[model samples]
Target: MVRAAGKHTSARLVLICVGLLGIALIADFLWASSSSSRFALIGANWAPPVSLLTPITIPNKGVDSQKNNTTTGRVLSATFADLPAPELKWEKMAAAPVPRLDGAAMQIKNLLYVFAGYGTIDYVHSHVDIYNFSDNTWGGRFDMPKEMAHSHLGMVTDGRYIYIVNGQYGPQCRGPTSHTFTLDTETKKWQNMPPLPVPRYAPATQLWRGRLHVMGGSKENRHTPAVDHWSLAVKDGKALEKEWRTEVPIPKGGPHRASIVYNDRLYVMGGQEGDFMAKPGSPIFKCSRRNEVVYGDVYMLDDEMKWKVLPPMPKPDSHIEFAWALVDNSVIIVGGTTEKHPITKKMVLVGEMFQFNFDTLNWSVIGKLPFRVKTTLVGFWKGWLYFTSGQRDKGPEDPAPKKVIGELWRTKLNLGS
Candidate 1:
């Protein structure tokens, strides 16, 4: 009878232990879920800026390992206040008809127009897809006048007309073209515009004060960087004789620059100075080296028509082919790739974002991206920012197969919590 009583006690103890273990697992799951949600809330609110610091690991190199060293000599910091963070809503819309990378987008009224870009295969596409925001659906597809494939082509719009500027075409970094064309949104037709003075690609163009300003691209298939600046004005609404006038050139020009006009002044930032290919028979060429240069310099063209170099970015070798937009009078630079991975030595996509305050000339970490993206089309409409299709992953050199994304993502910009 004593043994039977002891067995009953042991069985009861076993049951209690099992119940305790189950409770512990449930508590752990709840904690993990809450922590993940908190992080998501933080990302949706504000991305804190993070500085990429290279610690001097070589022993006795006379460099302090504790100090964060970057090529720009600026330390990145985040100042988070106790104030409530902004609440953001993200929606996944209809995907594009075709997957593309290095595309441009322009929104006219309720319709969003996506232009030509490199497709999934070897060739570029001239397909034009339209998205109607009012109906929340993608409409019919249109074709460009010509079949041209150029990544990093400049595109801008002045409500009624969309301008397509110089870009590279054909296979393997072919020479840049001076082709410029404008599409009438009302008529659904394209009209040839005055050609650029110099052939280039990856130039940033903006419509400022009824004039189209084109500046800072690469010439000769990105072999040479050009600082040539030009502005085209339509005289008396006459499109036939539109004349492009020369403007003050940028102090330094490079490929894949992000340009925007804020407060009547032009701001250019983040581009590299080197070509993709090294000179023939060079030592670097013999080694098949790639991504030789990257830049993080920021410059502004003031109302006085003078270019002033601003403080360098905290992250050196940043903003190479990234997406940027002016939000709340601040420049928000999104995801782009760095030249080389710090650990793997492969090219890496920078998933973090930074914001530059025009008033104070300071930068802050805004937030992190859900995924890595580059050469994307960014559009701002109705208090929301849209990040469209782009290339994902680290490009061709990535150990895994790269993907050209077609997903359309939008996030509310100014929605208060």
Candidate 2:
């Protein structure tokens, strides 16, 4: 009788275990079939089936299809289209004449004007390198104005004209400058514009509705963040007003933020609140690294000229002011520095490419770069996404900056038809 009772108990335990396993499998099937399963579960640590990661287009009815209505009139949502990964084939292009960081570049006609920037620990470039998209070659470089800032410049282009605003006049944490200049790409000449009332370090600069808007940057001390906003009416590479007029200040102002004007809407995203501080009584403004708060906060200047908050980036990113390119209705941003690692407490260089969909107001990691980098100058030309000239990282797993690179790279953008 005792042996029979033990056998009965063993049989019941086996049945219960099988039942629990069956329930778990059913639950997993249900979860994977759901729409939210397009993205892999957090900490999954395992590869899901390819079909589970395929892109699925869904109709969006709740959002209106109106112009300037925050949706960008996007009728369909391609939320997980880049899931698993997009077809990113980055090809090497002509190398830049010099390596630089904190530089600026703009695409005008068939030429990409790469501006001066920090060359090395002891050097700063004061020249412009032009890349001809037509022939895939670097044209003859030209000298910038003697007064042009070498780094931290806020630049924007209006057709044949390129506008450059205030920045650090020189290297080693030097004082910010108040000078502003505009260049005529056709004539290859630089013209002086009305200087900024208060000099800033890498303020968000953009052109909107016949006015040049400049906002947010580091103060003269090179540590404190500034919230001052100013604008000036300009035309044909010349400022119509002698003085900049005050505008609504950015709610969260800082330097190295990406600024763009899409369909009359102005946006500022990704920057840091603090920067290197100069040591007291230093002649060359020698500085030391300071604690900073890098944020992904995004803001938009609405049609009413009031700032409105928008969906922020997935994580904190900085030094991305010039590392973004507009593709269709999406802004494809390349590499930059992100928050420090939790365990190592070391700054983590961003290797992933981020895409911000204007229509959905959502951010996504579309792909990864060949190597991690920061302050990369990004441009979109003839269906190709081009990025060049920034500080490259040590390796894939290491985020420490290794060296500055001038190798230009481009990949065919196959996001949409």
Candidate 3:
């Protein structure tokens, strides 16, 4: 498990415990192996003296047709599923065209905006796509002028605009670029935003109280994932045209691009800084390195944006493609590749999902991914959590972007409680 004040792991149902400040709530999943549940949300929590909301799981068996939902300038597949028992309905908001590992997404209103990602494609893509759930249609696509790809790009949305933070151009998979961009939801346009003080890939970005904060990513010189934390005002998009000024640094280790906003703070999860070189389309394949993944740690920013490393990820796996979500009211980190196995040298798919709580800094267990999500973008919508599209490559024998999934799956949280 991630962390709990009491240090117990058998928490399936959540509870509230009275504490000094006020109260806190806790919960967990009594997950069973034979579970084939649909996207559902249930009212559950831990009453360990504090009170909080926790989402319980219910199995589902319904399915929907795989349809395409274009989100602006990006190519993605969207689908829908209704969990009957729980009466929860959801639509697949957005997806990346192919197996784009280490990709990211931003949500605004009914649409989900997807940004740069890398995979089988030879060149880095700076394209941005948005998906509208209301009309089940994709808006026009926009390009990220910078040659962007391969980054664990941290993403954030102000319910009106989407912003991109630190990412580097790599010669390994595709290449790297030192740039930042933001999408204006109203204008449906992308404007060059402020650039980071340093050029790094896979740093985390989040929004709180109208300000944008960026932390962690690998610089060209391979400095320990930039521990610096920077903040800027998102005043009428003018900030994009300038440079990113610096704030406080983490004062410890660095953070990866995999970040999530919970209870108003940015929880930056795993990622590492290394010398990576991809053949043509692969990113993070460093020279002299076995294409292995690193960074077994996790951390979060306080309301003040200060850094505090939390419990590391569940097991051990690394890939700029690694993704995280807040499913079932628990912070869930999922799929990415690792070069641990020689046969599948470049990358190997992961189905594991790790859940941790933002409050107690406690970690718990969760289910595996139901689909092959190689290039995944995580998000929450209408009471559900989503894993966007990704890809897989066959062993050298039939090596190609084997499975490019346009499928979208949701594990929603019941807001009825």
lDDT of each: 0.65, 0.81, 0.52
Q: What are the candidates' C-alpha RMSDs?
A: 15.9, 11.5, 16.0
Task: Tell me, by TM-score, which candidate is best.
Answer: 2
Q: Taking the tens digit of each residue's C-alpha lDDT, what string does model 3 give over 182-291?
A: 66778877777667676665666777556777776655544445676777778665573255567677544343436667777766665555535443333454433423
Q: Model 3: what TM-score?
A: 0.63
lDDT of 3 at 216: 61
lDDT of 3: 0.52
lDDT of 2 by residue, 330-387 (tens): 8888888777654455566777677788887767767657777899998888888889
What is model 1's C-alpha RMSD? 15.9
Off by over 4 Å in 2: 1-87
Question: What lDDT does candidate 3 reach at residue 161?
Answer: 69
- TM for every model, in the order presented, reads 0.71, 0.79, 0.63
